[model samples]
Target: MARPGRVAVAVPAALLLAACSADPAQPSRQPSDQPAVARSTTPEPSASPSVEPEPQPTPVAPDDLDVSTATGTVRHLAGVVGPREATGPAFARAADWVARAFERQGYDVSRQRVDVPAGESWGVPVSAGRSANVVATPLGFDPTEPHLVVGAHLDTVPQAPGAEDNASGVGVVLAVSAAVSGRRTRLPVVFVAFGAEEPRGPSDDDHHYGSRRYVALLAPAERAAVRGMVSLDRVGVGATVPVGSASDGDPVQRSLLAAARRAGVPAVPDPGQRSSDHWSFVRNGLPGARLGSTPYAGYHSAGDVPAVVERAQLERVGRLLLEWLAPR
Candidate 1:
């Protein structure tokens, strides 16, 4: 999960219902008012306009799933943008880096604003600020069609570089996205790097602000079209991946476990593990699960560096996701 000491706070039924029922605000489109141009008395024959063909998507080969790409991203996020607290300048830089990475992979990228209210991070008072969630989708993704969401938290605790806490998760997500870019799958996928996943205070509402805002902004059709969501978090340290969810018998979690088995990767189930971004979707009446493992020496400390992340572990997670989404 995110941190070691944070506990899961149960969301009130009323709040959950409200969030599920609310509709995203749409922008008003006003018609332009201008004087009409007079038609020519004798219209001349118009020439045929030339049309250029659209560019085709670049196909991703099997060799594109390189371990170095995922390792480099983890090193950069942990060593370069170290201590990326939510809504901070470092976190903003990380978000920008993620957006650029998605653009390089030929995906359409967008940023969703996440407003953080005044709160405390681990008892330290924090001022209200704005953060963002970076979202990436295929060039012509349709919202009304069935789709899947692959997400990972981007922010880290102030005292830790978070190589294992979450830089690893973001790295796996990017690597998986790159490997599946131009491939055909059963459902289209949307990748998101969530901000503000670290606990900002004692309450649960202080965490997962980015993901909660994302789900809240989804239109009814968009929400309904989501088949499932998988949050890759802290998959760098463990030998066996753990697939967890808020409750038992979750179809998404079960599917992930089955996928791992089919891919010949070791994975276990961790029920009632609600300490990541997937909880945001599950609480809002959506199917979601977290794929990660715990029991690391450096949970949220300065010792969580790039050296602690294992490239093999990253590849295992990436391969599992690929098998589940776009199986060869």
Candidate 2:
């Protein structure tokens, strides 16, 4: 991993500061409190079942990816919390960092333990321990209304610096949470950093364990109040936005299209692929959409480090998602 140190983000300092106001309040956390997981609308049939393999995006030069990488967002995050392996100490520490980010945004933060077998990662034998998820909700919202969850997984493969695999996703979620504080939304927004998203067993159930448990544990009332789930996975690289959970012409995809056009983000519709944490929500009848990168060459290797993340791409995806959840 690159030696930990502060680096400059590409945008003008003033612009970055203005986009997310700083908060003086210290973070307040309650780790045991799990946020409500409500039932979402079933994947209602679409007249146009728009599900197809997304075309591969043009390969970006490594130099191009780094030209505008944001230091505070991507670099700082990857450095401070590099390669947080599932259920490992670093993973727990990563959760702390995310909780602090939420508090800095003036939102209350909490943690919920995710069930995983003792001493293992997805059936792969390891000494990794229990994992937990982070949750934060903006204040002064109507509790009666179903809420929208904006989530990203927080775990990485053993000993690997998962910059694009995930740290980028965590940073984008923080950026979005920071940018939209105190704003009203069509549905209340909840920010989560799910643990154990990496495969824990050979079966599909072993993967996306964090979100899967989150949905399974939700009280029926909470489930009933769920409006939707927006999962952000591996979003720090690639220029194109891959919509993983929503099919062509689905309500969630439609909303994303409108938001992307509004935000001027160029995106390619994906086949609502369930390879990421969003699938956890989809199986439980909640509408979901994953915005992520094309593919990273260093995906699960030690080569996946901070320098490879596209700072500008990270900012664009975060901004686009913020627009999608903003009151509309």
Clashing residue pairs in all predictions, respectively, total 0, 11
lDDT of 1 by residue, 1-328 (tens): 5654443434466678887787755333445785445556797979989899977544443345677778999999999989888878999999999999999988999999999887777556677888899999998899778999999999987788999989999998999888888876667899999988888777678789999999999999999998999999999987899999999989999999998888888999999988899999999999999999677898889899999999889988888888788634
> What stretches of model 1 exceed 4 Å from their correct place?
1-64
Task: Report every candidate's CA lDDT.
Answer: 0.87, 0.73
Model 1: lDDT equals 0.87
Off by over 4 Å in 2: 1-73, 118-124, 140-144
TM-score of each: 0.80, 0.74
How many Å off is the CA of 70 in candidate 1? 1.1
Candidate 1 local Cα displacement, residue 17, angstroms = 99
